[model samples]
Target: MRVALWLAAEVGEGGRFVKQQLREAMPGVEQIDRRMRDLRPAGWAIMTYRDRAGLAPGELLLEKIGLPVWEKEHRSAGLRVITASTRRKVFERDGNRCIRCGILAGEIYPDETEVSARLTVGHVEAHKYGAPSGEENLVTECSRCNETAKHLAAPRFDERQVWDEITELPRKDKQAVLAWMAAGKREPSRVERVMSHVWQLPGVQREEIFRKLGRSLS
Candidate 1:
């Protein structure tokens, strides 16, 4: 029982079940085959190494997925087509850093295969906007970050509607509303408020924004 619980903690969920088991039973633990079966619900997955003894030095295992990635498709080619390019030129141009996040591929990832063309090339502008094909519009993104941006990028909402909704709220709420409307809330509250005030005061609502994003900010 102790061995099973320890195995679960080390290679399985390692959650409340394992903690409870340890508290209830302690001292000498032996092997770990008995507790493997019937431990998890159908999709409550756990990952493990093939064998610890065979592992190369400094090669460790990932024992849990934590969140399973349901890959709908390898999106790079589709995105390239959408952008009217056989290859995303901007990814080649930027040297594999997400244009928005400034994360370079070699900086964080371990896979040499992922360092170049396999790195996700994200669109700085909307794909619907002529599906920008030029290198000026593409940004290198990791698949994870690209997934997040794609999930967040939906149909546009009216900024006027946002102002009307939050005009009466506290300054903080007003900031939240503006931040929600911006391109991923990259700026601080104070910066947004000042920008809004500047735009509103001058009656030049978003010309500056267009100018700002017109070229590579990188």
Candidate 2:
């Protein structure tokens, strides 16, 4: 509600704002960023530096405001009516990483280091009719990818290019890739599991663990 009021009154469409500004407006409200993201599916166009140039890190560009969620009529525009337990289970099963891009929560994307990825639950086959909101049907996805996928606006992948790369792999590797495709989810290796857990740890703990591992390797 505060987010809606602030955007509608203070920062109108095409206005530039930052995380700090939002935090200031809604003092003591943690997860204001998440509140902002909740408005996305309702037609809000809040672009970050990663999505739009000229915006600095922590800055947000409000390209367009979709639904007036603050209004009584349109209050539930982008809200997903899922249970809290379901949300937790889905996140845990996916190891709190985006299955689409393999991006872990709060980790910066390789190409867009300025923007950190936030994990969200998304349907594996979004367009499928009567898709159940179960562990089998849901997967972890970053907010960016989830929104793009929901809108069917993801960039086109060249099948031939992808196929060529796949075909060039060794026979065992090709089979492994095929198995993952068939299952529709890639099982993480032991090292990947460790890395995912470490990525979620505090900075100090992560660094200490890395040093310990380095010593063990030596």
What would the per-residue lDDT of candidate 2 be over residues 106-188, giving only the tens digit for each residue?
A: 99888665678877777776724334656677778887787777663455467898899899999999998888778766678
Rate residue 109 of model 1 by lDDT.
41
TM-score per candidate, chains pooled:
0.27, 0.60
Lowest summed lDDT window (length 10), candidate 1 = 37-46
Alpha carbon lDDT of residue 169, candidate 1?
94
Top of the candidates by lDDT: 2
Expressed as tens digits, the lDDT of each residue in 37-154 for candidate 1 is 2221111222222212344443333332221212234222222332325234665555445545445554644323323322555566643323555566666665445544654323
